[model samples]
Target: MKFARSLAIGVVSALALSAPAMAQDDASSSGPTTNWTGPYIGGSLGYTWQPNTDREKNERIGFDTNNDGNFGDTVSTIGGANAFSPGFCRGFAKGGSAADGCRGDRDGKVGWAVHAGYDMQMGSLVVGGVIEGGRSLVSNSVSGFSTTPAAYVMTRKLDWNAAARLRAGFAVPTGTLIYATGGVAYGKFENAFNTTNTFNTFTESNRKEHDWGWVAGGGVEQKVSDNFSIGVLYKYTRFNPNDYRVTAGQGTPPSLTNPFVITPSGSTTFARTNDRFVTQDVRVTASFRF
Candidate 1:
C-alpha cells in the first residue's frame, strides 16, 4: 500500500511539473492545434491492491451428524454444546490446535490490461467510450477453527475481468486531457478449500464462478504526438458475491460413535461477508491513436 501511495504521488508530481512546460510550448508553437477526435487502442501495466483481502467474517462450519441428509444439525461436543468454540481466522492454519494461530495474510500483486476506445471532440470537451480486459494475481482466504482441534481453510482468487465504460473530459490547448470514467464490469473467481481434519472425509463443490459488477475512476492523458499518448489511471472495481460449499461425508461405520460424524450430515456453505470482491488499481498506460 505504501508503494502504491508513493507511485501515485510521484506520477501526480510529474504531471504537475510538466503541465507548465506544455502550456508554454502551446503558447509559442506555430503548428496546427492537436485534435482530440480519434479511435485508439491501449494497454496498461499496474499494481493491484485488495484492501479487503483480510476482512473476513460470519464464516460457518457445519456437519451432518445424523444419518439424515440435512446439515442443519449442529456438531456438538460430548457434553451437547457447539464444537466450534475456537472461532475463525483470516489465514491458513498451521496445525490442529488453536494456539498454533494462522499463517500471515497474503499480499496484493501485479495486474495488466488492454483496452480500445474512441473519442469525439466538441469545442474543448471530449466524450468517448472504451472497453477493457485484464487479469490480476490477488488472492484471499479464511479459516475456521473447530474444537475438534482442526482448521478448515477457504480460499478465493480473482481470475480475470473486463469492463465497458463512457469517458468525458476537458481538453486543454496544451494537449492534456483530464477525464472521469465509470461503467459495468464482469469477472471470474476461482475457489479452493483445505483442512487439517484428517478424521473426516471432505467433499468440495461450486469452486468457480462468473460474476458482474462495476468500476469507476479518472486519469490524466498527455498527448505526445498526434498518434501517441501516455497516461496514469486509478480505478476501483467490485463484483457480486459468490458461494462455495464443503461437505463432511458420513463418518466411518455411519454412527455417532465415529468422531468424524457430523450430527446433521450436511454441507457447510458460505459466501464472503457482504458477498463482494473489491480491488483498486494504479496503472501506467500507453495508447496508439488512429
Candidate 2:
C-alpha cells in the first residue's frame, strides 16, 4: 500500500508540472492570433494625379471679351469674339503659338499622409474610423490668348488636405484585410495669375481659400505581425471650387507720350468655371497597432 501511494503521488506531481508545457505547445500550434481590434497609427507614401479632362475655363474672358461694363455686349477681336480661343495648356505658359498646342498636361506628383484610427473586430468583420492629414504637389493652370498675342495664366495649387473617414473590412483567415473607406474631406488651396500683356494692370482677390468635400477608397492590408501591418490603398478625392478672381485694366506705357495701345481698355473681372478639384491617389502604407 505504501508503494502504491508513492507511485500515485509521483504521477500527480509530474502531470502538474507538464500541464503548463502542454498548454503552451497547443497555443503555438494553433498559429498567431491576428486580432485587429485596437487603435492604430500609420503613414503613407503615394502618387497623386489630377485627371481633369477639360481645360480650365475662364468665365470672365469667355463672356466679357471687350471688358465693357456690360457683359452682354459682344465685341469681336482678331482671335474671335471669345478671348480664350487659343485654348489652355497645362502648367505655366510657354511663349509663342507653337508652344501653346495643349499637348502636355501636368504630371503626377508624390504625396504623403499620416493617420490614426481605432477598430472593433466582430468575428470576421472589422469596422473603424480614422482621421488623416496630408500634403500634395498637384497644380493646374488655364491660359487664354488674346489678339494682342499675349497669354493670361491662372493657376490653382493644392496646399494641404485632411479627412475624417469611416472604414468597414473583412478579415480573411490568412491575416489579410480588405476594406472600403469614405468620409468628409477638407483642403487648402492657393491661386495665382500671370500675364504676358505689357499694357494691362491686374488686381486679384480671394487668392487663398479653405474648401470641403469628400473622399472614398479601398485597400488591402496584411498583418506582418500581431501589432504591425502593411498595405496598398487607392483613393479618389474631390472638393468644391473656391472663388478666385482677377480684374484687369489698361496700364500706361513707360513713355506717357505713347498712347495706350492695348485693346479692351475697360476693366474686366475673370473667374473660373467648372473648377472643382479632384485627385486620385495610390499609396503604400505601414501601420502599428496597440
Candidate 3:
C-alpha cells in the first residue's frame, strides 16, 4: 500500500510540471517576439535633381520737367528697364519701341546635392537632422531697350544652393524607415548684361548667406539583410527673403562724349526692386548600418 501511494504521488507531481512545459512549448512555437530598436549611421550616393525658380519685379514712376525742348517716345521695355528720353527734334514721341523694352524672362535648371543624417529609434518612430550642399545651374534672360533712358535689358543666372535639415520618421518593420525633415537653406545668384553698347558683364554677383527657409520631405529605407539598406528621398527648400539690390547708373562717360555733338542720350538705369527663390530636389542613396 505504501509503495503504491508513493508511486501515485510521484506521478501526480510529474504531470503537474509537464503541463506547464507543454503550455510554454505551444506558445513559443507561434514565433519569437520581434525586437525593433537601435542607433544607426550610414552614407549614400545618388544622382540629385533640382528645379530652381527665381523671380524679380521692378517698376518706376517719375516725371521730369526741364528745358531740353525735346520729348521722348514710349519704347518696349524688356528686362524691366523702363525709361524714355527726347530725340533731337521732338517735344514728345509715342511708339511701341518704348512699351516693349523692359520685359524680362524666366528660366529654371536642375542640379544635385549630397546629404548625411542620423536617426534615433523610439518605439516605432525615428527623428534626426541632416546637412547637405550642392551645385546649381539655373538662370533667366530679359532683352529690351529703354526709350526714356535709352538703355537695354540684361540676363540673370542663379547658381549653387545648400541646406540643413531636421528629420522625423517611423520604423514600419525591422529595417524599413519612413521620415520627414525641415530646416534652413542658402544660395547665390549672378546677373549679367550685354548692352547695345557694352559687352557681357556682371552687373551683380550676389553671394548670400544666413538665408532662412524651411524644408520638408520624406524618404524610405529598406534593409536587404542584417547590415545593408538603400533609400530614396525628396525635399523642398524655400529661402527666406532672398532679397537683393542693383543700381544701373552712370552710362555716358563725359570723357567719351564731345560737347559739340547733339548727344540725344540720357541716363540708363536698371535696379532690383525685389527678388526671391525656392527650389526642390530628389535623390536615391544606399547605406550600411551595423
Candidate 4:
C-alpha cells in the first residue's frame, strides 16, 4: 500500500513539473491545442484474471483432516502407503478416496467499471485523481485428496471491486493523452469449502466478505469531440487476505494396495484458510467530459 502511495505521488509530481516545459513548447506552435481540463464521468468494459501465488501460502488455505478443533492439518497429500504425515494426519491414506487433489484457480472473465475524476490541464500535461469501481466475473474451485487419505475441496469467487487513484498523462500534438495511474483499491468476495475422510465429509458454503488493498496501472484516452472521449486502461489490483472456517470428521480409508491394511481412527478436526485475491484488468472506457 505504501509503495502505491509513493508511486502515485512521484508520477503526479513529475507530470506537474513537465507542464512548464510543455507550455513553453506550445508557445512556438500555431495549431490550436486540445482542451483537457474538466470533470468527467465514464464507463468501461474489460477482461480480468488472477495470478497464482506460492504454494506455501496457498497451502495455508487448507481444511482439517481430523474433526477436532485443531487446524494443523496442512494441505499436502499422501501419495503412497509409506507417505509420512505429522500430527493427526499420521497413517493417512491418499489414493482410492473420491478426492484426487487440493487446489484452486482464479479464472478469467469479462468485467466493467464506472469512473469519475477531475483533471488539471497545463499546456500539454494533465494530472488528476479518479475513483472507479466494478466487478470481475471470475470463479475458482479446487477439490481433491492427498495420498494421506484425507479428502478436501473448496471454491471462491472474485466478485465486486473498486479503486481510487491518481492519473498523469502527456497529451501529444493530436487529441490523444497517454497516461499512468496508481492508488488504493477494495473488493468484495464469496467463498465455500468442503472436504472429509471416508468417515467424515463436511461442507461449508455461503461466506461473503470484503477486503482493502491497492491498484496501479495506465492507458491512453482520445478526445473525438469536446464533450466525449474514448480510451483503454490496464490495471492490477491487490486485495488483503480472506479466510474461512471448516470442520472434518475422522475416517480410516482402506488401503488400495492391501485391502487388509487399516490406517487408523479418524478424529474431529478444525480448519481455517488464508487466501488473498489479486486481479489483472484490461478495459476500454467511454467518458463524458464536462
Q: Which candidate wins on TM-score? A: 1
Best by lDDT: 1
Candidate lDDT scores, in order, read: 0.76, 0.70, 0.45, 0.61
Q: Give the per-residue lDDT of model 3 (tens digit) for 53-78.
A: 23333322121112142222232233
Model 2 misplaced stretches (Cα beyond 4 Å): 1-32, 52-87, 96-103, 253-266
- Give the range of the ten consecutive residues with the poorest summed lDDT in model 2: 254-263
lDDT of candidate 4 over 93-195, digit per residue (tens) = 2333533332335356778889899998898899999998887767655444434455454556777888899999998755668999999998787766554
The weakest ten consecutive residues by lDDT in model 4 span 84-93
TM-score of each: 0.87, 0.77, 0.55, 0.66
Ranking by TM-score: 1, 2, 4, 3
Total clashing pairs for each candidate: 12, 0, 25, 19
The model with the greater TM-score, 2 or 3, is 2
lDDT of 2: 0.70
Better of 2 and 4 by lDDT: 2
- Higher lDDT: candidate 2 or 3? 2
